[model samples]
Each structure stands twice: as structure tokens, then as C-alpha cells.
Target: MDLDLAAVRAFVAVADDRYFGDAAAGLGISQQAVSKRVAKLEADLGTALLRRTPNGAEPTEDGASFLVQARALIALADQAVDLVRSRHRALRVGVLGTRIASAETVRAFHETVPDVGVEMLRSEGLADALTALARGTIDAFFGRALGDLGGIEARPVYLEPVHVLVGRGHPFAALDGVPIADLAGRSLWVPGAVRPETEWADFYRVLAAEFGVRVDTTGPNFGVDDLVERTAASPELITGVGEKIRVPWHRGVVQIPVVEPSPCYPWSLLWHPRNRHPVLPELVAFTREGFRPYRPGRDWIPEPDRPAFTA
Candidate 1:
């Protein structure tokens, strides 16, 4: 049934002031208007909310009970309005891989959304982040779009060419860019812990297949430093990393570009279309303004062609 908030407000005002004229004055309306609104409320509720007293008016038994609920409703409404207007416009976003961000992007986000308090949630991989997004655990996600995102809305933020991390003393370290074919005889180490699902692992596996390379996976407890330390210790093992990521300069670890049909990692912002966060669109807009068309080099394609599924 349709409940009129205006009538409820009028009834609450009458109940508070105990007089139609006083209630009308408080509401800045005529006494006749206040009486009509209260009557309408009573008619709709099928109960008498107020009764005429000798001096002015008084609430009936039912009106006294509903008076509390009416004030509570108005209080809740006020709270909601205050929440939207105050600094509580917070957004929870999932960030994948290393949590490193460019200085410019950070500055832009703060400038564009000065009032929005952003809470960055970390996940191990894109699939995990996207899962959090789908489950309503996060308002948005920042990372590579693994494959077909069935229900999520994705927007590309930047395109980063994949880089190979190798030991400084390795044979490929002297080269400017390692060709994809050069990985044929090399072993690529990937972290196996908490990756959300097999799709991400499958993408790398497909890359290994298309280029005739050996894909090796490690433990269920691997981390960023662990992967780097392991790669630095083994000259025969190398790993893939995003060029934009700022890995701490290890004594023996070096990062090199991967070229010859260079596999580009496309970073995107993913959000559910029905998200309720008021600041989510503002954040997405801020991110888009920062990266607009971020393809740093030549031979830029929208996505990686090797994975086949991501294309």
C-alpha cells in the first residue's frame, strides 16, 4: 500500500505540538492544511491518530504508538540525507598484483574525489578481485581483465607491455627486449597461491603453448618478494611482470621488455553496473581522465592476442 510521508510528517508535528495551529505554524502551513494532512493520514491508516481535546488536540492511543515510529522514520530519512552529504561517501575497491600506483594517478584520484574516502582492498590476482566485485565485497576492481566478464562492466585504464624479470647475470639480461621465442628453452615461474581460479593460470599456460615454452608453477604460499628472490637465485628461471610495476631493485634481478608480438597486459577498472556506492562513478571518471588512452609504445593492441580467449 502507498504510504504518504508528508501526511506522516504532519501527524508527527501535531502529536508533538498538541495543537493544529501550533503544528501548522511549525510546518509553515495553514492550520486547515495541517488538519487535512492529518485526516488523510488517519484515513489511509484506518485509525484515528488525533482527537479534539477541550483546549486544542491530543493524540489517540494508536497515534501515540505510531508517533514514535513516525519520528523514527523522519530521523532515518534525515540520517540518509546527511550520510550522502557528509564525508561518508566511501568506496571499497579491489586492487590486484603489487599495490604500486603511479604518482600521477594517485594525485588525480585525490583531486577529483576530494571528499570520497577510498579503501583499497588487495587481492592476489584479477580473477580474485573480480570475484569480490561480483560478490558485492567491493565496489570496484583494478587489474587485468582475464577473459569474458559475464556480468561485470569493465573499462580499460592503461595498456602495459609485459616485461620479463631475470637475473642480472643471465644471458638474456644484456638484451634490450627478450623475444617471445627466446623463452622456448627457459622456465617461467608463476605464483600459485590464492589466484582465485584457473583461468589466469590457463592464460599463461596458453602463452607457453603458443611459444613452445615451459610453464612452471610454485607453491600455494608464494608472494611478490618470494617470486623475485626465487627468480634471482635461479639463472634458468624467469618470470613475467608488468612494465609499469616498480619492483624494488634487487642486487641480481633485472627487468627486460618482452617483444616480437609483445604481450600487453591491459589494466582495467571493473565494477558491477548496479553498484550502490555514490562515489563509484566519480572514481571511474577520475581514473578514465588520468589514463584516457594509455598506450605507451608502438604495436599497441587493445588486448593480448596470444591468450586467444582475452581477444
Candidate 2:
């Protein structure tokens, strides 16, 4: 038979206080209302749950047996509510990779609010991260928001300066900084830029087209270790990396700044409008407070990402 939780709660309260007037005061309800709820509960069970005594109301033998299960039911129900409410759950954030600048930003945010737990999930790229955000698998994402954003809301967070990685014998290795024009006619080997539709690939494509830098996507795309080893072995081959990216250390490889209007990779924090995570606003506030504005004359941003940086 179906049972009303309200009536059950009223019965438990009445049993605890052992008096209808006392139970009504505890429940913030009238004595008559409490009595009616207990009466209804006893009738539904087809047994006397409580019996009036000279001192007060005492639970019957049947009421004593059912009290344990009723309390358990209330405890389980409260736990379920807390779970759905995300009372103490960690905030899940999607980042492109741990070695990139976005991951560092998330780390800094966590450090700022140490009490707020954070879970960092690595994503393939902006497209992958955005899909996770839309699916509600991730609370927020950190990446460049280009093309159609649809219902996604974004805020510019950081602009990481671009750097060139070259072998010791390479011509640019000895220089303090390589100008953007100097990269022309030079091939930038990016193993992960094979997908033309991905956000990172698209950014490099535009960088190649605008600056006359050729992006060579060679076969057998390996991880960063292979990329670092191969780049260090070849004197002529060069690759572009973000200044903040933590690449594997190689004695033969040197990282030099790409200056004279530095090319910057734009980073934005993206989240769905429907996401109601309490810590989300705190993260947004942290990013806003620490944001370093893009220098229009000194920094070079891609055309697609220009609006966000400019705005």
C-alpha cells in the first residue's frame, strides 16, 4: 500500500515527543493537525500505532516495530536529495591537456579556493570539451571559443604568448627572440594538427595563412616526448609551442620567444547558461580579477578569436 511520507514523519515526531501538543510545537504545526496526521497514518496501517496513556501518548507494539524502518526511509530520502543537490561534490572542469596553459589556470583557480574541490578532466580540444559541457558531463571548460558558440557563454581569460622550439644547430637557436616575419618560409612541425576541423588545427591554419608560416603535419603523430626528441635531433626542423606549455626537457632543444608582435593563443572559460554550480561564479570572478588584457598593437591574435580578445 502507498504511504504518505508527511503522515509518516508526523507519526515519528508524535512517537518521539510522546505527546501530541509537544510534537505539534516541534513540527511548527497545530496540535489538531498533528493528531489528524497520526490518526490517518494509524488507519492506513490498519493498526493502533499510538495509544493514549495517563502521562502521554505511547507507541503500540506494532508502532515500535515500524519505527526503525520509517526512520531509515527518511534517512535514505534525505541522502538522495543531497546527492542530486551536489552539496559536497567536486567541481568538474574540462581542459585540453595538463601541459597546456589552460590546465595551469585551473590549478591556480583551485589554489585560490582550496576549500572548493576541483576535478580536472583532459579533453582532446575545444570541440571535445564543448561537447562534454553541453552533455552536462563537465561543469565548465577552458579553451578558445571560435565559430558558432550557439547557447554557450564564454569569457576571455588568458592570452599565452607563442614560442618557437628549435634544435641547438638551428639558425634561430642563438637569437633572443624570433620576429613573426622571420618565421616565413620556415616550416612549423605540429604533430597534432592533422584534423582540419579541430579548434587548435583551425587556429594554426589561420596562423599559417596569415603569417606565411607553413604548418607541416607529418605522419606517425606521437606524443610530446617523441615531438621533443625529433625536434632536438633535427637542426633544420622547428615547431611552435606556447610559452607556458611544459614540454619535456631536452639538452639540444631551445625555446625562443616569437616577438615583434607576439602571436598569442587565446583562452576562454566556457559554460552552459543552465549550469547552476555554486562555485562557477567564484571561478568566473577569479578569472575576471586576474585577466590580462590583450595588447592590440603588441600582440597578434587570430582573426576568428580577435573579436573575443577585442571585445
Candidate 3:
């Protein structure tokens, strides 16, 4: 039978308080209203649930049996409500990969706001992450914002310095920092950048076109470990990695800073304008407050990303 939850709630309150007046006080309703609700519930169930005594009311034998089920029903209803409202769900955040600089930033943000629940979703790249954000599959995303974002809101969050990775035998491996100009005509192999429309591929394309550096996209793209192993064995071939990316260690490989107007990867936090996750604002505020502004002359940012980072 379809039960009126309000009436069931009123009955539970009266059974617990043993007095309609006390139950009304707890429920912030009048005693007469509580009695009317309980009376209606009794008529619906075709059984008297409460009996008024000299001191107070007590549940009948049938009421005692139904009380347990009534409480369970209320609990299930409340859980369903909370689930739909997203009150108990963890905040879902999309990132390109767990080893990159953005992942480190997410880790730090989580530590700062330890009370807030956060779930990190590993996406392929910015394009994939933005699609997830638009579809409401993810609450927020961390990546370089490029081109038209449609209705999504984006904020420049961090500028991670770029580093050149070279085998120990390479000449630049011994240097403290390699000037950006020195990279001209040098082959920089990036295996996974073969994907055409991805964010990092576009970034590298722009960088290569502007800087005259040759970006080699040759491979059967394995993973980072394979990249690191290949880089350690090849002295002539080099690669670029973000300073904060946690690459697997190779004793023969050395990471040298890229200087003389260092090229920095611009990271931005992206979310739908309509997103109302409780942790979104906190994360945005934390990003704004903690951001280290870009140095115009000392840092080189791509043209499309400049507006967000420079401003």
C-alpha cells in the first residue's frame, strides 16, 4: 500500500515522545495537526496505531510491529533524497594524467581542504576532459584552456616550468640550464604527441612553429616508462617534460631547466558556469590566492593561453 511519509513521520514522533504535544514541539507543528496526521494514518492502515492513556500515548501491538519497518522506510527515503541532491557524493575532478603537474596541484588542493571529498578522474587530455565537464560527468577539469570554451568558465591556476630531458651522454645534460635558443634545429622526440587535435599536441605545434625547434612525433607510443628508457639510451634525441611531472627515475637521464625566457605550461581550472559543487568555489579561491603570477619577460606562454595567464 502507498504510505504517506508525512503521516508515518508523525506517528514515529508520537510513538517516541509518548505525547502528541511533545511530538508537535519536536516537529515544530501543532498538537492538533499531529493528531490529525496520526488519525489519517490509522484510517489508511485500518489499524489503531496509538492509544491515549492517563499519562501519555503508547503504541499498540500492531504499531510496535510496524514501527520498525516505518523507520527503515524513512531512512531509505532520506538516503534517496540525499543521493539525488548530491549531498553525499564526492566531487569529481578531471585531469589529464596522475603523473603530470596538474595532478600534483590537485593533490595539494586536496591536502589544503582535507574535509572536502574529491575524486580525481584521469582523462586523455583537455578535449576529453572538457567534454566530460560539459556532459556533467565531471565537476571540474585541470588543463591548458585553448580556443572557445563555449559556456565553460576558466581561471588561470598555475604556471609550471618546462624542463629538457637528455641522456647522460648528451652535451646539454651537463649544463645547469639549456637556453631556449639552443634548442633550435635539435630533435625533441615526444612519442604520444602524435595525436593531432589534443591540447598538448597543439601546444607543441605552436611552440615548434614559433621556436624553430624540431618536434619528433615518431613512435609506437608506449608509456612514460618506455619514453624514459628510450630517452636514457639515446644521446642525440631529447624530450621536454613539465618540471612537476613525476617521471620514473633513470640514472642515466638528466633533467635540465629550460631558461632564457623559459617556456611555461599554463594550467587552468575549467568548470561549467552552472556547476554548484560545494568544493568548486573553495578550490577556485585556493587557486586564486596561491597563484604565482607569470613574469612577462622571463616566461614564454603560447599566444592563445596568454590572455588568461597575462591578465
**Cα lDDT tens digits for candidate 1, 58-159:** 888998899899999988887677556533556777765433553234445867667668767667666676678777677787766666787898776765
Kindly list the per-residue Cα lDDT of model 2 for residues 1-311, writing each as its tens digit.
98888788888898899889999999899999998988898899999999899989888899999999988887788767755776467889998788889889889999989998999998877778778878768888998888777788999999999898999999999999999999898898887888888888888898899899999987777777888899899989888888999999999999999988898989999999877778989988988887887788799888777777774
Global lDDT of model 2? 0.87
Model 1 spans > 4 angstroms off:
1-87, 98-108, 111-115, 124-131, 146-150, 192-199, 290-311
Scanning candidate 3 in windows of ten residues, the lowest lDDT window is 79-88
lDDT of 3 by residue, 49-149 (tens): 99999979999999999999999999899866754776557888898888998788889989988887899998888778778888778888999888888
| lDDT assessment of candidate 3 | 0.87
Give TM per candidate: 0.61, 0.73, 0.73
Each candidate: what lDDT? 0.72, 0.87, 0.87
Clashing pairs in 1: none
By TM-score: ranked, best first: 2, 3, 1
Between candidates 1 and 3, which one is better according to lDDT? 3
- Stretches off by above 4 angstroms in model 2 are 1-83
Candidate 3, backbone clash total:
0
